[model samples]
Target: MTTTHATGTREEWLVARLKLLAVEKEFTRRGDELVQQRQALPWVRIDKAYRFDTEQGSVSLADLFRGRSQLLVYHFMFGPDYKAGCPSCSSIADGFDGIAVHLANHDVTLTAVSRAPLEKLLAYRQRMGWTFPWASSAGSDFNFDFNISFTEAQQRDGEVEYNYLRGRHAMDATPAPEPVVQFAANCGTDAQTYARDRPGMSAFVLEDGAVYHTYSTYARGVDGIWGMYQWLDRAPKGRNETGVWWKRHDEYARG
Candidate 1:
């Protein structure tokens, strides 16, 4: 088949591959440095009592740790009004089941927290066939305090702050982006309700019987943990994106 991409002899390919290898190695080293910097950030002690509803019943934030000293919470975007979880968040979470076991054994409990009711979260989890821990922050300030979920008042007053930026998210746009509208409809809600809940991840540590917020990242900062994107980045065509081209796992048609 004729191809538009560059093609060359084996010798030329090897030369190019070797040069790319050097650049990849440097990128790896830079990523290592970032790891150190992330860990070095000051930990803020959480004094507010945040509770979550789990299969075990309502529990404190510390209980979500599952007796582990470290906790990693994926701020899933499943608002109370939505009929289903966000497609983007669902895509990111598709990888959780595979890694949850390894993370648990490593003394880190990975849990997903969302504003949706426990019943809703559990039903969706069953639909997705995910076994990872999921907790409900419905009627709780946990999601709001972590800055992952917002209220109608906050959205109306333009007080929503996300990814360390104020009033700049595409989801918060006046007319709502096409992707946001599409995703919102897929979740059985409107764009405004869907955008109120943003996706992110947060890390916490239990020290001296107290919990401290270690770090949190939002928006593209979460790309590192979205397993599919990592593989796509290494693929021949890379992301090869025009727009929102993915759906929830079960929504995809089988060949």
Candidate 2:
């Protein structure tokens, strides 16, 4: 049950606080509604044989999940053509990598997938100083089937966003998803690179060592886990908007 305010101010101070309680209850109700909507999303099966390159060696979709019943794979935005990944995506993945071990204990194996070749993925991972499992899906239709790869025509139809050279929203990029595609609709693109409509996060359930795609998400659907600012925003040096930077505690360690 929600708490209520008292009728007293400074002279009757308790009453004002009581009113604030009512407002809190309304907020709780709205929050519950939002959660319900999120849980209502439908699931899909991944019949394609998506292969990835890992540090240990090459692996198939089923092999990646180990023995866990649930697998959550993040489709990182590092394409084979690009030397570097999207900065925003890099920022989000930074946190994801660190949390992998913790999540594994709970029967949820989390990993990152990208279209970059094995060497490229390893190079970037080293440069970014990440330890989470990363795999390459290059030379596979996995990206296209998942709606993240762009076709030349889709780029012309305003379906992809690229971040190559000087990023700009243009129709010049090659291989983009058509407007009819529900995944990449209204996606902003940068001319230097063509945006694929397949950018997304996917969840899977493994029973008897076989994996079944249970849920997947893209765009804002991943907003919850990608940013550290949300938690920091509640702190004293809080941010009121995006673009605020955070300094690591270790970086500020003083001898």
Q: What value does the lDDT take at residue 156 in candidate 1?
A: 84
Off by over 4 Å in 1: none
Q: Which portions of model 2 show Cα errors greater than 4 Å?
A: 1-43, 159-194, 197-199, 232-255
lDDT tens per residue, model 2, 178-212: 43121122113343353543346878877755566
Q: TM-score for each prediction? A: 0.98, 0.68
> Against the correct fold, how does model 2 do in TM-score?
0.68
Per-residue error for 176 in candidate 2, Å, reads 15
Task: Encode model 1's per-residue lDDT on 1-255: one tens digit a residue.
Answer: 899999999999999999999999999999999999999999999999888899999999999999999999999999999999999999999999899999999999999999999999999999999999999998898888888988888888888888887775678888999999999999999999999999999999998889999999999999999999999999999999999999999989998
Weakest ten-residue segment in model 1 by summed lDDT? 164-173
Taken over the whole model, the C-alpha lDDT of each candidate is 0.94, 0.65
> Which structure among the candidates has the greatest lDDT?
1
